[model samples]
Target: MTADDIARWFGEMDAELGGATLFLNETERQLVCSRKLFERRDVRYLDMRADFDQLSDRQVLDLTKPIPRVQSVPVMALMVAMYLGFKEIYLLGVDHDHFITGTYVYAFDLKAQRGKDDSVSSSGEILTSRHDDFQSLARLWRQYRVLREIAAANDVQILNATPGGVLDEFPRVDLDAALSGR
Candidate 1:
């Protein structure tokens, strides 16, 4: 089945998108994550938190009935995908260098809104709104190494779609054939 099709079989729009896949994700942003291509299958809502099994099977995405799955760390999303019956997780924008290095996809000033309290407002909640901007690129590189090592140790095959950067680290695949199930 197509990756998108597989996604539908596994989870609905309110389900989790693996952490590695939340690109430009914010509670207020309806941005489509290139890595988690399933969001493109239909419109998705940015939830700033992970609700975990709170959504009913028959639930629909709307004003009253919302999908409980929210923005979470990459590992959380990956774990959820494992349960979704996806045999192979194809990554389209697994650009490690972008994060491992100092050049994150985008930047924002968190300190600007230092004292904003989220007590009564539900709509104001920012899903994982923004990732922690690591001050030390070197530290991020170390964390990245650990993440890669964990993936390698687990033998969960990751295919990088950028066609550049360090791809030889993971098993390469003829994506077209895989998509066609050839």
Candidate 2:
């Protein structure tokens, strides 16, 4: 998620959401910490370091050490969940379809009104494009596979509750059933 998404969530649903823990990179944590809403709310920010190396081998993420950067925030979130001892992790809205659509649009910002077009990096750099040029979407899939292996080894269950799009690394579950503990 982008800074705008975080801001919007806190801005619009601050009361309903209660509290949130944001796992952000150093730069992102600094940026988010500067926000007024975050300062007043019960929000905990964790720092993660950038790791450009692809997940070439199966490994478990050690949270006590520096958390390695993944292809996206959702993947990073999965690592966080595992580290937090969540045995049954249910993923919601983890659609990895940017490669298919060739855009960086998110499910919440489908109209492209809040993200992609006006997204600014944590380093205060203006990003005009909707997609990243460096990494291929395939790398994301590979990272998910690595996460799946890690989850299996740790005896954790990861169920993807997303409606559609890519990301077939984990078993799919119905969102409603998962939410209701069915």
In terms of lDDT, the poorest run of 10 residues in model 1 is 58-67
Worst 10 residues of 2 by lDDT: 107-116
Off by over 4 Å in 1: 1-76, 83-86, 98-155, 166-169
User: Tens digits of per-residue lDDT for model 2 on 30-51?
Assistant: 5556776656555444455645
| Full-model lDDT for every candidate | 0.40, 0.67
Count of clashes, each model: 3, 0
- TM-score of each prediction: 0.32, 0.66
Q: Give lDDT tens digits, candidate 1, residues 1-182.
A: 44444344334433444433432224434223543535444443444343333433322223222333432244334433433434456655444444333333312222223234332123333222225433333343443333344455555545544445443444556667767987
